[model samples]
Target: MAVLSLKKSNLPSVWLFSFQVIFLALFVGLKFQTGYDWPIYEAHYAAIQRGESFYLDFEFGYEWIVQVASRVGLAFEQFSAVVSVLEVAFIAIAVRHFFPRYCLVVMAVMYSVPDFYLIPTFSLLRQGLAVSIFLIGVCKVFSGKKISGLVYFTIACSLHYSVIGGVFLLGLVYIFPLSRMTFSLIFAAAVVLYVASFDIIRGVVEVLIVYVDPKYMIYLDRDVFNASFAYRAAFAVVSLVIFTCIYSAWMRRESSDGDHFDRGFGLLSYRLALLGVLIPLIIFGFPTLSTRYQYFFAIFVIGCSLGALQYVNYASRIMVVAVIAVTAYLPFYRFLSSPLSIVYIPYQSQLFYDQTNSTGHDRTNDLLNQLDVLWSK
Candidate 1:
């Protein structure tokens, strides 16, 4: 009987390991991808190899990796390929505590996750690395490794200053031990604030910009309700489900022995996730500068969702999984049916580039003509 129990537990772990390995292989096998920022990152890495003074455009931590690759006599392409795999490894470590099956399911379905399969995934190089580290750090903090988590957070900041926003959110988690009622009241105030005049909201955004680089002023714009009502309604529905999962967690702590789940971290991460998701929807009318916070927000939600699952009764488990699955599906469906049929029409990759380049075909024109088809009758 003991051996049988062990076998059951080990089966999921083995499957989880296989899932991680497959993801690493798929991402690393790519020699090139067509994210909009690929050319920019390609140029930046070349400048580093040439020993040009190019640190102003990128952070030192990112440049440091390119420099090491240069010294090791590897091309920027090879280095970037390997580093992409490493970032995924970091995320795996970050969510190691979650039931591997659930984590794999989420990763497979959730395109919003920066590293998940998508063109946008490749667009963020430095920021993606920073987010990977910060996620692991938050998980570590939740697991009671405060010092280790702080070290990871510091490393994240070194990679990209934007991670400061994540750090600030974590700090708030520690400062304010929150409750469901607190979140409720806060959301109420946010709606009130949302109804206020644009001048007032713009002033709030202005105050926020002061905390970051003034150069970001270039990205800030007045928020617009550009999406259909259905899209907006989806956001509200998802938010409510997340709030319910989190609030139910508080109830679980009060009723159960608390050994089956790690509510402390679940609560901390959920509070951060809630605020992260809420502020962007409530206050920042447009997801310009504030949009980056969504990645950080998503990580903690994964943490909370998985952590809560470990403890909830069978019936509660049904609701939690259902909520997570539906909430994740919304953004993913939007991605596939969007203009991607234009940008990623042929889903070109390094393999295509190699084959076509060998034949002396103009790859740029090929991509353009593919996109042109979507526009033409």
Candidate 2:
């Protein structure tokens, strides 16, 4: 929780800063036809352009963006770029406000965790934007601007209804202000439930079905629970272990010149990280819910993990960073080598559009075709 001065010497090196800028530029300017969900969104944009009815599958804020972009005559690529810029801007603002000295480290850690970066920004576009704005709201709330935080949370939920879960969790945490020990006990219980293969959450989901939209029932389909459950559960557990190490080191360090607000924010972040880890286990049967919501909490996990680095001794810091780097890299490498890599690898940009030799576009089409075949089966 120590607050480092914003001195030039304390900032990230020029090379690191330049690399981040360049990487962000490429990320924002990504080709519209390359990402996993781009085709669906592009189709919706085309529908809007053709004067068709707006796609109700997405939330109103996203539909509004499409309509405005279509009316303005912007290409789908341009619209996508605009959204990416906004997403990055929101994330940058939040990171700078909260962890100014660790901006590079935070970005590095986030990138290392594919779900935190690639899956969200490159695939779940609407949810990505919502999460980014939600992060800003978290900053506002922690800074004592509760009303402004509420407004941001409202807008985020409007953009992606799935974000309502995150809002609800944030509200619970703010009101109750759980201690680290409570989060640990909750996480341990969740892990036990997951290990037992308990379906208690099914009861909760069934109750929700009565009050929530019927369309959401699709997520409860038996086919949704597959081998990915174990994989995602393991991932969450590993991340929780990593967070426990960082937090323990943070807790052991002597108190610094940090005020009550700084210390409180760190504790809050640790609790949020614990909540993030518990989420996948708490909703074990719902694979889609586990996958999507974990990323929402990962924003906090990454921040809290990196922020705690300042408090640890040099040896412990190095060890934690090394573990994080390895853990982060393994998933990233596996992702790029996985069959799903067709959706993201061979990165393409709108700046170099080619009608005949669009490898990325062609690969994405092939992947989507395979998905259609699988779904039909």
Candidate 3:
């Protein structure tokens, strides 16, 4: 896609981007006893404080962070705040590096996608940190720093094993470039396979269980796969993948070949975005795996979408932005209507809200009531 021409001295854009980075860091960092996984994280923190051994399921890097925080006498809230800041900082670094002129717009597109921003930032702490680091590594790799990129990728995988899939995908795309037509064929085949291979996939997982960590079996739980929310989420991801595919194709055709960096990086983004489409379709039966793994590529998909924006006129750009905005909002609306919405509905800051209070208890009860209603349906 054509690059947006913004003045280098656009002070207002820079300032606005700065404010967003600061606000996001503070907002997510200071959140108190909210988010889906806060209770689990809090329990882990408490275990560390009691001098208990680290949970085997958690990555070594994450355990090290918890251990360091516990030894330094930092509370769970404070530790979380630090991690949150690092996450936001890494994300900002990547955004500014790759899309300096349209950093704000690119960031807006990222934040609009809940899986790319909200869920990762607020709930999936370890994977989120790893993804953020991996994003910077992607920037380095695209800039021709292979050794540095490998180092970053290693560190990212150390934080979350889930990053291995992403790293593998990146390496595959980098080493063996595929045409857009090949990607389309693969995407179509994946959809067909997903429609017909549920039992086959289940059998494969069962066979691998003996060799894999027992903890990962939760990803195959029937309850998770059968949940109404899972279907809704899968639908949203598939829609996003299709949208990204279309725009990325437009970007490749409309963009000029004069800028080597833009052309090369844009092509990489396009290929990765196509992989993002295939991920969901290939793993449709494994919702958790599909959702968690897709985000790694979704980052590139967002880049493709934003890059495509440059090829369009103002009216079409506005229309594309509107579509992106609505795509972002639908997931949030679905979450609000779900039983677990109570976990995040009213944002609570550690500075002002007491999680142990009756208000918190009421929210918990409300959540239970909603779950009962859902299950009884």
lDDT of each: 0.60, 0.71, 0.72
* Model 2 misplacement above 4 A: 1-9, 13-22, 55-57, 195-199, 206-213, 222-225, 228-237, 253-266, 333-337, 359-362, 372-377
lDDT of 1 by residue, 1-105 (tens): 111212222334555555655565455446464554565677777787788866456777877777888889887557766766766677666555543535554
lDDT of 3 by residue, 62-136 (tens): 888888999999988899899999988898888788667567766666776666776788778898899999988
lDDT of 2 by residue, 110-152 (tens): 6556667777888788998999899889888888898999999
Off by over 4 Å in 3: 1-12, 54-57, 191-200, 210-215, 227-255, 258-266, 358-377
Model 1 TM: 0.77
Better of 1 and 2 by TM-score: 2
Clashes of each: 0, 0, 0
Give each model a TM-score. Answer: 0.77, 0.83, 0.82
Q: Which ten residues in a row have the lowest lDDT in candidate 3?
A: 1-10
Q: Best candidate per TM-score, number?
A: 2
Full ranking by TM-score: 2, 3, 1
Q: After superposition, how far is residue 303 of candidate 3 from its true place, in Å?
A: 2.0
